[model samples]
Target: MNKDNENLVKSYRLLTVWLLSLFILAGIFSVLLIRLDLNLSSKVTTLFWLCFVSFYFISLLLMIYKTERVYYINYITHKEAQQATKEERRAFAYKHLIVFCIATFIFVIYSIVSLIFQYPAAVDFAVFIVIIIVSALRTVPFKLKE
Candidate 1:
């Protein structure tokens, strides 16, 4: 196969690995949270939420990194990318960054609101937001770069 093809395969593999790793991490966290709810005292539930929030952010960061990698890979594989104007690349970057920021802000806001209301669903929602923001942001950047 050609270099571009090789790169494409590598990119796909990398994306797959990142996705699988994320799935495993989420699964482990879910199991642990369930166990915590069942075995621990009620007070520990708050701790679980906190843990969830932290994990959420960590996942987000990882996703962003992955997105950047994917975009970089695309740029490398696309020969015409060199011919593209610099402003075009910057525009793409800006758009993706804005999307990432908006998504992140939404989830962060939700988490804050939930914390204030002391709502049970807040924890899960916050965690969900984090995961979504992470995935969306990551994918958007990579795709935009193309």
Candidate 2:
């Protein structure tokens, strides 16, 4: 298959998985809300969501950092070899920075909204604070290698 077709298939597969997971999560919450006491349900859901977001957020960052290492290495190598033009390099950097900013903005907004709902865990609040701080660091030009 061509690269385009492969990418399209991968995208659809990812979307399908994401949608299915979201539906399952919603179904779980729905059952909880229906079967449990209102206050108890809120607490349970709050803890579940807090843990879920934290795990996903950490894993997302780790995955991005790992993949970013490959991109950064390729860019550096190509740049030194004069295979990558200055304009192309700048555009690549701009794209990455923009994505980082957007992701940070999204998480910060999610954190804020979650806070407004008053998640019962102090851990959620702390994690959100850390996310905001890390987002602020997204503009740095250095590699985020471990």
Candidate 3:
């Protein structure tokens, strides 16, 4: 396969591993929190969530930056996007779809688990909403100039 295809595959693999690790980490943390019965004071819980959210967003940004750098065509202008080959466009769409689906699935699972555990106002619900909104916005195709 050509370099583009190779890079695409590599990116997918990297994303898979990164997401899986995130899922495992979330699971472990959830289990621990449940077992601990969240006995900590509200201040400590808020602090912990603040740290977790900060770390999560930072890591997510870094992962996206790294993945885009590794893949060809990290950014395409409107003209360039229009000129891109059918295969290139398809590959781009597929990549976005895969990411959206996987992320949505993971967050949905987390949210459900948290709800089941009776954490109605859990951060996972907020994360689930944010993921859906962002993914949907990102997946929307740009309008082509007539």
Candidate 4:
């Protein structure tokens, strides 16, 4: 395989590992949070959400600026994108879709578990919706300027 194909393969492997690690860590964190039984006051809940939103957006911006260039082919400009084969594009899209599905599954399970444990689950639901919207936007087909 050529350099580009090798890079794409590496990116897929990295993304898979990173996402799996995230899922495990999230599961552990959620279990600990539930077990702690920390009843957060309204003020603390609001502050938690505020901080979550702020950090989430900041991290997203950083990922778009830094990680996408390294791991995502769709981040290229139209001219550069034109050089990529259709198969490459399709493969990348499929990989992204798989990632989205896995993430959605993880979050959905987390939300259900939170509800079952009688923990505050509104944040989990909100995060699930945000993930869906973000994945939808990211997976929208890109048009090349003719």
Candidate 5:
């Protein structure tokens, strides 16, 4: 098979696996929400919703990162991976940074609301850290071996 075709197959596999994982996560959270009556208060509800939204967004970002990596690798295999023009790569990196910033901003708003509602900082930070790590990883450039 051609490199492009192989890359397409890999992307499909990743998407399928990630989508399944997300569905399972949603199911678990839904059960928790129902069993514990987690949305009884404004604070608890805000925190819950924040967590739900953050997880979905981060999952999407990770999926994009994975897809981009596949594209990069496939381009290299096909000898189509030109040395990225400085401005082009910089702009791409900047765009990812902007996305991270937007996600962090939303998290901050949720954290403030959560704190006001007596939610724990530890819980907030734990979720925030995951976002930070994923965003940070996405910004790094990967070199390919010949």
Candidate 6:
């Protein structure tokens, strides 16, 4: 198999892993809270969500760095990438970054609103589901550099 194709698959695989991990993390948090019979204040729940989102963003940054190095900057600048155009590679990066930013921004907004309003206990789980769905739906085709 071609190296570029392999790298593209790896990126998508990592993305799926990231989304699933976040979803599971949120689910477990909810289950544990209930099972432990711990009463959490609204402020505490908000704080928990804020911390979770911070960790998610950090992990996502790491994944983006790894995939960007493999596909956009390092791979495209290599000898085997002679057929790849720099402009196109950069455009791919720019577009995906924008999508990531916008999706995360909207999610954060919804989370804040829900938390402040003291929504149902399912809010966190719902947020996780939305995030996973959004990310999965946004997965781009694994285009390889020719």
| Highest TM-score scorer | 6
What TM-score number comes out for model 5?
0.45
Higher-scoring candidate on TM-score, 3 or 6: 6
> lDDT per residue, candidate 6, 55-116, as tens digits?
58646755554455324322234333333444444445555555556666666676677677
Q: Could you give the candidate ranking by TM-score, starting with the highest?
A: 6, 5, 1, 3, 4, 2
Candidate 3 residue lDDT tens string, 57-115: 44654554444422322444534444544466555645554666566566656655664
Clashing pairs in 5: none
What are the clashing pairs of model 1? none
RMSD of each: 7.1, 10.3, 10.1, 10.2, 9.1, 7.6
**lDDT tens digits, residue span 1-146, model 2:** 22222212112343355457766877887788778857664544565565565455444334433333223323344223133333443454554555555655665566566667865566565665666567546544543221
Better of 1 and 6 by TM-score: 6
lDDT of 4: 0.50
Candidate with top lDDT is 6
Q: List where candidate 1 sits over 4 angstroms from the true fold.
A: 1-10, 38-94, 118-146
Candidate scoring better on TM-score of 2 and 6: 6
Per-residue lDDT over 1-146 for candidate 5, one digit per residue giving the tens place of the 0 to 100 score: 33333333323466577678878987887788789974576555656666666667556555544454333322233232223333333345345646676777768786777677776756676667776677657655534322
Per-residue C-alpha lDDT of model 1 across residues 1-146, encoded as one tens digit per residue: 23322322224555566567767877887798787776754434554555455455445445534343324433444444333344444455455545555565665566566667666765555565565657565754353335
Tens digit of lDDT per residue, candidate 4, span 1-146?
Answer: 33443333323554465557656765775687679988866544443443444344334334433333223444555334345554554554455545565555565566556555656546655766677677657656543212
How high is the CA lDDT of each candidate model? 0.51, 0.48, 0.53, 0.50, 0.56, 0.58
TM-score versus the correct structure, for each prediction: 0.45, 0.35, 0.37, 0.36, 0.45, 0.47
lDDT-wise, the better of 2 and 4 is 4
Model 1 residue 45 distance off true place after TM-score fit, in angstroms: 9.1
Clash count, predicted structure 2: 0
